[model samples]
Target: MLNQTPLWKYIMVLMVVAVCTLYASPNLYGEDYAVQISAAKDSTVDLNLVDRVNAQLEKAGIETKAVALENEQILIRLNDDSSQRLAREALESALGRDYIVAMNLAPDTPEWLDNLGGTPMKLGLDLRGGVHFLMEVDMQSVMTKSLKDMEGDFKTSLREERIRYRRVSIVNDVVQIQFRDQETLEKAEFFLKNRNADITIVEQGELTLVASMSETKLAEIRDYAVKQNITIMRNRVNQLGVAEPLIQRQGADRIVVQLPGIQDTARAKEILNATATLEFRMVDLDHDVRDAVNGRVPPGSELINDQQGVPQLLKQDIMLEGSHIIDANSGVDEYGMPKVSISLDSAGGSKMSLGTKGNIGKPMATVFIEYQATNEKNADGKIIFVPEREVVSVATIRAQLGSRFEITGLDSPKEARDLALLLRAGALIAPITIVEERTVGPSLGQENIDLGMQAIIWGFVLVLAFMLVYYKAFGVVANVALTANLVMIVGVMSMIPGATLTLPGMAGIVLTVGMAVDANVLIFERIREELRDSRSPQQAIHHGYDSAFSTILDANITTFIAALILFAVGTGPIKGFSITLMIGIVTSMFTAIILTRTIVNGVWGGKRLEKLWI
Candidate 1:
């Protein structure tokens, strides 16, 4: 009974190993070379596209393992790398310029295992090969936009307070108020300074007041712009069907994005760089569209073309900004036509309600505004955004629409879905330009994977050989636990969402193989000490494990703390390394202590041995 483990503990141990082994087995099956097809914004993806792809592959004499349509994309698996390249070329030629055809590696996970929520660990950009972008937020544009909004608010507030102002305009990132007299200027300055804590008010002259954001406020604006752009970029990247994307703030006004397993850089750039928003404005029913088109636009109306290229007149004042939209979904209308249902926030609802109160019968136009980069670059080596506005929908106000509404007259379901996706991705607070971009090819990624695997395998083999020769029979037990430790690490990584293994992460795994046997070494040495002191084998094993527990706990806890610190403070590859190190520490502790002890106890627990093999 000295070293005996409880029956329940044995069952628990076996159950854990079984589950881990089952999950970890998927990685052994390897991956397949595949080509993926994604539809453009106006195009649609269906089973027909899959059939066409198969037909093209067949015509090209390219053998394909399988073809499946999933998540609005067609994935065609090929037999080898040659077939993959040939299929990609053939499919791209067949699909023309309407679809994005890219090479990818698809996991060959069995259907049953996939259904059971079993998946291989996700590889990072460095391991799987993808595109990396370093984007810089336009802080100047951010400040300008903020000042413009503040200028509008200031003008509205002064008019409501009966404080007459000659003009309220934004100049050089500051809101300037030109009042007719000093009394009105003082009143406006006092009101604005008290109302907005983030801005500082300065009396410029006898009848002028200047309001600018404080330094702290400016810093906050820059930080918030970068963070918000990162979030929106992440949402947009989801449409690319990337498995694990890394989007994070790099500096004060820059973000680092890594898209793993994405070979279509053009499509990725289109999705990430595109900025779209919707504006709700009253249509100018009194103004003639022919006159507006001929450059005789009304005083407060602007001429814009709809999606169909027809000119229309609309009020310049925006009743609701796209930022007020909370959610959007694509669905069929009552007449079975494609439509997009949109929900607004509280402020947006109030604005819509008030704006539509007196204009029930008037038509409201939903103006779609997109800022696209031009082919020309500015002096600062940045692309300039050209503003493109079009009226996507013009609907009559059936009643006072508030909070929720639907935009009908969509050309197709694909258009509706795309509009919904754009709305759901949210509007960028400020435009961003990619300052640097790098693409990691699949061959290099495979090379990294091979090297990483070699490091892990060699390290494991060395450790296994050493333990087997030194401790003999007891070393075999340690090796078993060590194998279990590795399995559990991979299993846990696969189970956790957003946990990606990078090159440095593989190094962490290799290091874990070396460090995993430390506890076993301590236990075996302690048992030798106990046995030399004339204790029985069972007593030596029990006392050795009991005494070694404290040392193992302290050592592993300290290392784990370091790993946590690294994870908290590090970025990108450092973070990946820290994750694996932390996970390895945990799994190693469990396997080396509890698991190895269980084996030792069950095998040689109640025996009286004359000699010990350890």
Candidate 2:
């Protein structure tokens, strides 16, 4: 009669089958030496662009692995692993043809992906060669948006109800409105509540109405802002060609972003930090900057530009701040001048509509940027106060915008393109200085890989010899499982997206190989003890596994806890080590506890009498 194998044996066989089937194929991995073409951020992308570009590459006899569209960017993979010239040419052609916004090459494709493909699980920056960014959210902007919304609602409701207010001001989180009397304040409060305004009346003095946005409403606004931040971060990371980046809230007003295998750290930083605002403001038809620079203006006032090609003079008022800008991009105007295309939100569109209505025939200057020259407050003193301001005009803005906007006095084409990328990403709150930067050249990575391979080979030889001697025949079974375990781990790693196999992580895998055999050692030793006590072969096998289960569980559980600790506290490569260590512990335990036992039982369970080896 056929007796079915135990549950553990079935699982082990299934795992062996899966590992073999998944990793044994050649085309499972991504192509080597491939360049990725992407879109400029905040710009729409056409998915069919990949087919068009691939058609061109195919003519060159280059086979592409896959064409993936993520975050509106098309990623093209091809052979010729180190053909930078070819990659650059292909990328530029694609960009010139409007197939992609930008193109870049990761020094190397992810090692595991190169051998295994099809949506591999991506690794985080800590586990791969990538960028880690800690970005500070503009809480002030969030609060300001809330205030503005509150003010708009208040003004609209007051006007409709005929409630006259002498003044309205927002200080701290409170909105203070000075009405004529207490009756007016009470009436205004009633009107506000009736209109369903999310405001709380804090004080109603003789002629003042103090109302504040509700705490719940403020919290809701903050939550909304956080959601927006996540969306923006995801969009930016995708555009940068990062695989499965992790962008999550670290604190109330901070986001923690982890990008894997991103070569351009500065570009990644720029993308994550940009606040893409697109605004159209009329040049102050009132002021002249040329005259002011020549000492024709008043004591403290300055000149600036509007959306149209004109200069204006007034108090430096940002009528519509960055929050209203929905999107922006760089393009060439009809005159072949570099210009930025912008889209406004409904409120901004309304303002723009009103500002430009019937004023098209008149001059309308677009102020591209605000330039404040760096100078000492007292001509060589240390104290730095924003010294002077000048508004850039439509023509100046166009010239300065670069590839995205051609700034008039760009030093070179490179400078123009860089500025264009910056604008597409968004404007920064302040200048972000790179205090630290390190580039990992391909040569360095290759050297590390060579050393890592040598170490792995040595480690495997050592573990195989150790297992062969200690457990004897049973030890050989353990070695087989260990070999298969290594293969499965590699296959699994390759299958994971963004999973980078760094040197430290490889070390973790080596360490796991020894640990993988420990469970088999425990079980085998238990079986030997049973045999020594004259137990039957079947009883020996049963008791061995039953007695060893708790020991293996406790040992692996402690190791898992340690790995988790390392993952939580460590950063970069150390964290990579922790992740691999944790995964290895799991896969090893499975192979040892399940796979080793089945082979042992099948081989030695019935034949071994106490006299054979004891």
The positional error of residue 383 in candidate 1, measured at the CA in angstroms, is 1.8
Residues 144-177, candidate 1: write the lDDT tens digits. 7667666756765666568899987778778888
lDDT score, candidate 1 = 0.85
Question: For residues 33-101, could you state the per-residue lDDT of candidate 2 as single tens digits?
Answer: 445665542233566666766676766656666667644556665555444346546656655633333
Per-prediction TM-score to the true structure, in the order listed: 0.88, 0.62
Top-lDDT candidate index: 1
Cα distance off (Å), candidate 2, residue 45: 5.3
TM-score of 2: 0.62
Q: lDDT of all predictions, in order shown?
A: 0.85, 0.59
At residue 456, give the lDDT of candidate 1: 92
**Candidate 1 — number of clashing residue pairs?**
0
The 10-residue segment of model 1 with minimum total lDDT is 152-161
